[model samples]
Target chain A: MRLTTLQKFLWAAVAVALVAVGAVFLLVDRSPEPIAQAAFRPTFSLPDAGGRLRTPADFEGKHLLVFFGFTNCPDICPTTLAEVAQVMDDLGDQAGKVQPLFISIDPERDREMGLAEYTEAFHPSILGLAGDAAQTRAAADSFRIYYEREANLEALDVYAMSHSPGLYLISPEGDWLGQFTYGTPASEIVADLQARL
Target chain B: MKRIFATLALIAAAGPALACETVTVGPLEVSQAWSRASIGTARPGVVYLTIRNSGTADDALMSITTPAADMPMLHQTVMTDGVASMPHAMEVPVPAEGQVALEPGGYHAMLMELTQVLEEGETFPVTLTFRDAGKVTIPVTIQNIGASEPTCPSPDE
Candidate 1:
């Protein structure tokens, strides 16, 4: 059916309104605001391999891939560290711009030297850090990392720890960029790092 | 007779392709036996492998014994709510004509109180006892500390 001039004008106005709404939605979705930067830098002054206190500020110019795990952990900790090592390997020269930190939640057992041995096994550049009970708790709280000793702790050497497996990607400027869930591929991590860099 | 000979020849030609670094005992083929390098002598290490049963009957892995570890125990890593924990497992079941992969972040043997530090490129022997298949000795290769998956040379090569 042929439309009257008034009806045609009304349809054109509705089409223009739809296009304007679509453009506004797209603009809002693609806003230039940075994506979820941490309000403040989560700082920690944990002991390094040499029993010397070190802080995130020490690596001021490099991005930090921080993970919380105990050296005694047989499975998950090593798996994640392996993924980080692979990511660094895949990064090639860009690896120099990133530092992987493994913070031990089991400070009683994982000493500074032991932490050194553990982290060095994964990669020479990976740094192992540990702190006393209070320090460890504070660090975990700062990062919102959930960890607890197994309730039914067996004999001294046979106990297990239940810990969060998320890896925090902190920017060089000390802002939390994002968190990577467990089992994220190394290639994706490399891409994320490269994009951020 | 000629057709039967040709079939036999075909099977022989395909044999190497199916062969890997595996130990065959009874109907079970165990392959990719490996463990990660450890930092110290006392720290625990984990051993992983893939078990494939070809027979019509089910089998159960009873125990694992290795000199590298003072107390080798079968353990399975269970993840709940993004938290990982390990619990002792009595035995791992292998279904008939099915496979069970004892991999990282999954079922594995935890070597508690390691006698010696496991180093890369070193090999040790692990004897696995099965309920139906008796026992089989498999060489466990110590891989790099950051190795997450097993690497086997191509059988064709």
Candidate 2:
């Protein structure tokens, strides 16, 4: 059946409205500053694997990829470190300008368990950092990351830690850039970093 | 009969891909049991699987025992406002004629004080005790450290 002129005009208007909605979604997807802008400038002076004190100032001219997790974490921690390894591998030579750090929230246990070996298993480029309880709390507070150690009632001497699940990106100038939520694919993270780099 | 035996032998020999075979226990079917490679030997391990109950009565998973870890128990990863916490679950209910999936980011079997490091492409056995179904042992495949899903091979060979 042939459409009337009025019906045709309505269809055209609907098409335009759909296109407008699509454009809005695209705009929202491109800008990730809603949470990043709200975050404060992150600062921390933690000890690295080699027992040397390192801070954001130490990496004067490189982006920082920081993640906070404990060595004892089974599921999420290793998955994230693997993704960080993928990010570093995909970065190629540009990896030289990026520093990936695995900061231990369970400093006491992680220090004894050897956080260096844990991070090294994922990627050699990633550095493992562990500090005392007070230092770890300060670092987590600076980044607005929350972590709590809960005792496992079923098993004595065993515990689990609950923490914020995400990877933080900091600027070369030590500014809080943004974060990639848990399970964000390595390719998407690479694209975001590529644009910034 | 010969073909069936050959297939079973092939599955046992081909460890990783053929792991997580569906096994029936009473009125419940368990399948897709898998875990990820552990980072450190001292770090705990985890196992995920699915349970489909086909009976008229609901069944619950009571406990799990594995030689790979000294302490094996059921736990759920509860995410509240972006923070993730794991609380021990005494029993995981499997509703009658319904399914329960113990997967990543949800209910799973936690292996505390791992006796052996879980390496990628390796398989370990764990015996799950159900309230009504009694107990059944199943092999759990260890996938890549970042694997989020079980890697089960197709049966059409």
Candidate 3:
């Protein structure tokens, strides 16, 4: 195994050249964006409306489509879920690659059965989730969601909440990718998912 | 647009040319009254907008006026017993320095008992009545539903 000084220098030169070439490739990497590469995926292990713990890990290896809205939300929530179902239908075989999840910010009202019923109301694939105030707040904070209950001082029974309506796309690695708007056509979502897949 | 705003300011400052009191409300500034154009022989349509208070005083919106509708009340959409439902409302208020968003789903001016139809791309007039600001009219523009959910006016804005 003994080597001359010339042989040692030659080996050292070859190693250095390899390292230089690797660095150049790294610098010039213009590859497609990695799927859902969030530094820290804003995820939650919250309870379903039925009060059972639900975690984002349950939907790993698939795109987790998430939204923060209340069941009582008249305009946005229902319409958004409908659009999500439409997107799921559009995916066809690729649809299996993405799982739709509906997380309710109003855990107080979104009971487990209620959440299940709501999710089932749109499509069998959608999983409706809800949690107590703490868990709900944590989930929203993770996703940078803003929601508040609008209490009427005079009409206490008649109150509403304001919330964000963007659907998040989580990769199999749990990174948060950009989302589709509530009204984005289902065909567009399928196209984006297909490109990523 | 500049002329309209200028005329409104002059009327507000002068305090005499205006038929209604040129007063400030919560987050909503009152300029003039306006509503959507009702297509003749068509059914009534919904109208919505933001009511911002121009002063520090808190205010409550009392009513919305439209001649095209038989009744224009506050309406909200709710999920009850797993069913999607839209219900009527009596009032939506404007908090001090805060605003009343008349967006779809949560709080909206219901165009009930339509005397005429309101087609898309048509502008109309709506008189927003405030306890403090009196009656101010604003134009109602209709866009696709669910467009407001993602882009509600921000709090700092």
Candidate 4:
């Protein structure tokens, strides 16, 4: 017994509906899971340039733009700081809602070298943060930043530090939102922050 | 006499471009030499340039000397897995008939223990020693503290 045209059409429609449902399920299963907020949350208890202790709580309501470098880094650090300064400038009045921190990986020398003056040269809003060796290590670990002093046999006293060059973006609540790698233009950072803010 | 006068005029016209100058020594031509101004006297300065080799044999950059800093050494910023490390490079090779650029985030002359603070718009002489070319001094223009590229004087400026 041959089926009617309407019945055949109904069967075809049912098959298409089933396929569509399966496709949606497959796509949803294959999609990446959202990052765990707790795992990426970074914490630090370092001292600002004024020797006053600073923590994420201090900037409770402001977005944090964090960078790790030392005063002695000639190329990458300065270039990055300059970009940060540009970002701050572009932010204008909105910049007051953000706090930029330049965390020194080499606390011993950066302290003596005057981290405040170093950061101020870029932007007045930027606060240079430094701590003792152990504190520095803990802060770096929390940020997942890698740094090591390069030993030079020829000039033992003068050594350079090799570190992770990343500009991290932290939410006001202290969650690690994302990071802008080295070479990210200030315009891009400004746009990103504007959307978030 | 006309040809000599034209050559002199050309040199005079090219004077402004000297802000981004090229120096030739033996078979190597170094150009686009520049550095960023220092924040303070204590911070080290860095110099970046491009070296082109016209010779048939490869020549290595052996040493760098600059009055801007007491200890000028060749250093390369190496990045692996998003981690950055600047190691002292004993020599950077300029391949035969090839060019090597000492740009930012790459090979640079690390000026350790700056003798003087580098000021913007200033120029400093740095002597580069090559294995086959001996020595040649090039003027490195000082750009802004965070300048990513060599500052070229605009025609209007």
Candidate 5:
């Protein structure tokens, strides 16, 4: 015996739903993998913790992860470095091809040894760079970071400075790849970099 | 035996009970109200406050709410390649035992879109929304931006 019209309609609805779901998955498969925020590299000849000049030319053909911060930052600075350390680890052997750089915002306080000690705390692979205020400021401006000295004059060393919190990814050609925000998953970073590579 | 039992009961009744957090209006206890200042000439700003749980239960500070800005978010000021970025954060955990502190260079309730620049020693209403304690509206003191420590360092640098 033939089924009721209601029953036939239900079967047809099920067929349509299955096709729609399949087409969605097919479309999703065609899209590019989730790429990390593009990372930007700044030009600087500032000395590293060892007082050696590290310029853009040194990064000839390697992926670069750079962040601007000072030794005295208490929280976000440390946490973001820790996460970047994880990202380097996740890269495994390919990690050898990537360099993570820490630039000093407080160039006066973060001299050669100071920056070296700070970046080394996270990983031996991480390097700290520092330069005069004008140089650091240029790099910050290129990245669109907004930082200004706080208004109080009495506490010269205790003033507040606000800046962006992203680890920029730079290409071998030194073009800016997008950066990921703080606390990005290690797997996500590695996967994104791999696609870029 | 009756006298002994009565004495024992009295001792039990006299024992101190467990302490809970107490929420107070107006004045908030600040943690690490530092007298030290930054190395630059900019304003010396420190996030200060202590959380008191005056109840029998515990609560976590899920977020902070302030009308002073277009949006107030939890933020972590991180550094990379020498760049500092204060990224937005969703919540700051407040343990049952006490309140969490939002300190400088660590986690801070980032105030954005200020209706007016925060003036020193002025009080403004800031509401803290807790996971368990609901929302509490309190006045936050805008102290000297240039002061070095908790109270304020010397007027002279």
Candidate 6:
């Protein structure tokens, strides 16, 4: 049947509306939903103090508490690590479910021996991890940790490193929980972990 | 007069027994001197204390010397964007009628190239030279590796 020009225009308009509705539905179904911030996870494969490669899969079924610092840090690092030790003490038997990892950003100075001594001084269960320059950078980048070595003055052999201080909490299922800022009380950390666990 | 003399003797004895070791030189009073136990001789260690000046004039901490260490330098830990860096400080100022605290995350004395290891529970001597108060020697108690402050004896005792 021959259609009038107006009738043809109306049919074309109807077809265009149907196509628009179909495109909207396809777009909505194909696009991925936004993920919650807590569920974000960045993986890292780094070396432990014994020069053994460790990955996230190795820590499955346990919550991981990760911190970034150096051994020679006389003040902040030791203070924070002591707080973690206190948290462990506060956790009592439940401490077995939590794994505390100390990641060294200063690979040049902090080696197996130094890391071992430092971590052992704080707690026997706390594991010390360090990687080569490339691996260290990759891990820091993935964890969004900031670190920089200050200028060596007076030609002294010893130098200082500045880094972001915090405790990164990873869930048992390998998801990012949150970060506790510097000087977070041990009681608060223990309570948070208990609630989450 | 006899009672006053007896009271004075008791005060003197009590002063020395206080847990907070303090040395008064001229108008400067230094107290709570402490350092962490070192693992080895070559490793650097830190010393912390509080200095108060009661005199009418300001004083400056010129230098620190300890026989246990080869060289002692004044240093401060500065934190920027979560990074902590220790920079050598020429001198720390102590205002008159004010106090200055050398804490863990702040100013401290960096003992380099120790001649002997500082063992826990042991004490060492550190000589602080002030611009106006001259030099005062104080015993610094060696604390555990992670101790933030020196253990103070309770006042009740």
Residues A1-197 of candidate 2: C-alpha lDDT, one tens digit per residue:
22244234434433443444455456556865455564468888899877999889998899999999987777678778878888898888899989998889988788888888788877888999998888899999888776765432223444456677789999898888888888898899999999988
Cα lDDT tens digits, model 5, B1-157, are 2222433343345343211112453322223222111223222123444465545565666666566554454555545332344444445665544555565455665553445555433445666776766776654544332221233221122
Give the Å error, residue A196, model 4: 1.2
State the local distance difference test value for candidate 5: 0.55
lDDT of 4 by residue, A1-197 (tens): 22244234434433443444455446545865553456588889999888999999999999999999988888788878888888898898899999999999988889998999889977799999999999999998888666765432223344346677989989998899988998888889999999998
TM-score of chain A, predicted model 1, versus the true chain A, to 2 decimals? 0.78
lDDT of 6 at B120: 64
Pick by TM-score: 5 or 6, better one: 6
Q: Between prediction 2 and prediction 4, which has the larger TM-score?
A: 4
Deviation in angstroms for B64 in model 5?
18
Candidate 6 structure quality by residue, lDDT tens digits, B21-56: 778899988888887777777567888898988888
Cα TM-score of candidate 1: 0.79
Higher-ranked by lDDT: 4 or 5: 4
Please count the clashing residue pairs in each candidate, in the order shown: 0, 0, 31, 0, 57, 3
Kindly report the docking quality category of candidate 3: incorrect
lDDT of 5 at B128: 75
Candidate 1 reference-contact recovery: 0.62
Off by over 4 Å in 6: A1-36, A152-155, B1-19, B153-157
Instruction: Please give, for residues A58-147, the per-residue lDDT of candidate 6 as tens digits.
Output: 999999999998876666777788788878877888999999999888865788337888788767889988888988889887776667
Worst 10 residues of 3 chain B by lDDT: B143-152
**Model 5, total clashes:** 57
The clash tally of candidate 4 reads 0
The TM-scores of chain A alone, one per candidate, are 0.78, 0.79, 0.75, 0.79, 0.73, 0.78
Model 1 segments beyond 4 Å from truth?
A1-41, A152-156, B1-20, B153-157
